[model samples]
Target: MESAVEQLLHSGTIIPAHPLALDQYRRLNENRQRLLTRYYIASGVGGVAVGVHTTQFAIRRPDINLLEPVLRIAAEEIAAAGLERPFIKVAGICGPTEQALAEARLALKYGYHIGLLSLGGLTAHTEAELLAHVRAVADVIPVFGFYLQPSVGGRILSYEFWEQFVEIPGVKAIKTAPFNRYQTLDVVRAVASSSRRNNIALYTGNDDNIVADLLTTYRFHVNGEIVEKGFAGGLLGHWSVWTEKVTGLFGRIKNCILEDYKGAGALLQEGIAVTDMNAAIFDPSHAFRGSIAGIHEVLRRQGLLEGTWCLEDHEVLSPGQTAEIDRVTAAYPHLTDDIFVKEFLSQDSIKKLLLHA
Candidate 1:
């Protein structure tokens, strides 16, 4: 296992447009192609976020560095499952500064081509320090600045904040969950107006308006904060619900959004199907674990893993909740019938689930 200082000091050169990176992008394209083959039309792009906690078991057993190896295993598993282009985000809200940085570093070193950084903890820092951190990580991996929703104690980053940070050496993307549609669009406009055109990507994490926002050039806001135009992609948070189903539909979803397809609501419904189905299985009483549990619960039902672990003491979903999860999967219609749950559910259970899946 690489020490933190060793990992930090090793200035690994990023191969410019490396075959591996291009291969990854190509693999994503292939995944889309497979989806078209499956449905005759592309759906939307689907990406999954594998939490670090899920990999703890693997790290502990192998005498490996906890975060990096886990991320590598998860990425390989996601790719093997036909989600060749899974977007991996470090479990930011709960991770410490060192852990977050190490995870991001491992993500770059391993196959997780994209990185997510927390905006909540960031906003607490001065703009200068925040930009410095963003620049530092961006140098190694393509980073998507994560702005968690306000409900999770998130904050609003100003246009100037983005203006400065976007210029950082390696920063390339922004993830904003504007509580309201207005604020959501505002983030879109801000990214569009930024100096970097195609270089910088903007992803609206506000699921409610993402479909509609993609159709228009400008992201509209209730506050009348009609910002500049921005290209949309990278639905990092949406992955928990639609991981496998998304493999074959991302292109369709992108086209639907761009073409202003009429059945947008239905599209949302289709995407929401996985989330809703999973939610029905674990919600309310299981809220103690919060949405992270929802992510694990969905993965478990999909046969990704046999069990889950709550990172924090307060976040554990009750045993009754776990039983209910099993019940939900048992009762789920065609979704669970013959689906093979993958072995690389986490670092700890990788060998087990991989053998089974």
Candidate 2:
């Protein structure tokens, strides 16, 4: 299975950390969720990740039994999509070593390719303890390190931690999303410093710096020589919302990298506009209190969501979030794939897609 993770790193592109859909019952919305998975396939993401923060993992953890059922539905839909390349499936794993190991085993049992392992919950412990915990989970499934931003329950991880983490046998990738350039570079340097440096893949989860992240390469001095590397791709929550356009941006960036279109100096040179819209959608003004809500609101307008319903009521949009969503959607109509979402929102349309598959 090491070859499987290696394969994803080598050839796979964007892997959206997809959002979870709940029915009016506040339980899993099977059909609508399946439709969302198919939409990602048609929109062109090379992989999909569920059971992450954006997928409401916290709420699902209490009733852990619910997690696998929801995941099974996603696995079913991904199998039905029938793409030319395999859509790498990533299941999120968090909590204590035992809990994370259980989830990792579940991911492997269901044919998931990797576990997006989170270390936030264990921040209170020593690095050695955390490393032991991580190794325990790695024993079950190949795990991707998730250095999430503190704004959303993620704890800060030191360079020392990452230096040792990359040495772990089953740690195959790292999703650097601390949103701090210094922290991001720490993980990059740590990976480049490792014995498995060439084998480990680094992915960006920095929604605010997506274009720049994908466009830049990192350089490091290790073992008396210079080493260079760049993010293999992304596994982002932001991509879950504006999916179609995100996929297109991915294509443009890839073309620029492949053809050496250095005439403009940087690929998608005018990508600031996308980040500007992110500023609004991500609600930087309110310390991102409305970030998740903003994404839900955007999906609501596209008819993908019935309303902005989160697992917890307080998690709903903050005041004025809707206006921000409205402003961004109108300001950059091209960024919203509402038309594409609406086209398949109908039950009949999804049925046809499934029938063909």
Instruction: TM-score for candidate 2, please give it.
Output: 0.92
**TM-score top scorer:** 2
Runs in model 1 lying further than 4 Å from the true structure: 1-65, 75-103, 122-124, 207-231, 257-262, 268-289, 318-357
lDDT of 1 by residue, 56-141 (tens): 22232233333443345445544555643322333221243555577676665655555666645454677677667666666656
Tens-digit per-residue lDDT, 215-327, candidate 2: 88788888799999889898887888879888887887877778765533544454676777777667777887777767777777776766677676666777777776777
Q: Estimate TM-scores for all models.
A: 0.61, 0.92
The lDDT for every candidate, in the order shown, is 0.45, 0.79
Candidate 1, residue 329: lDDT? 54
Off by over 4 Å in 2: 2-5, 61-65, 261-269, 351-357
Best by lDDT: 2
* Clash count in backbone of candidate 1: 20
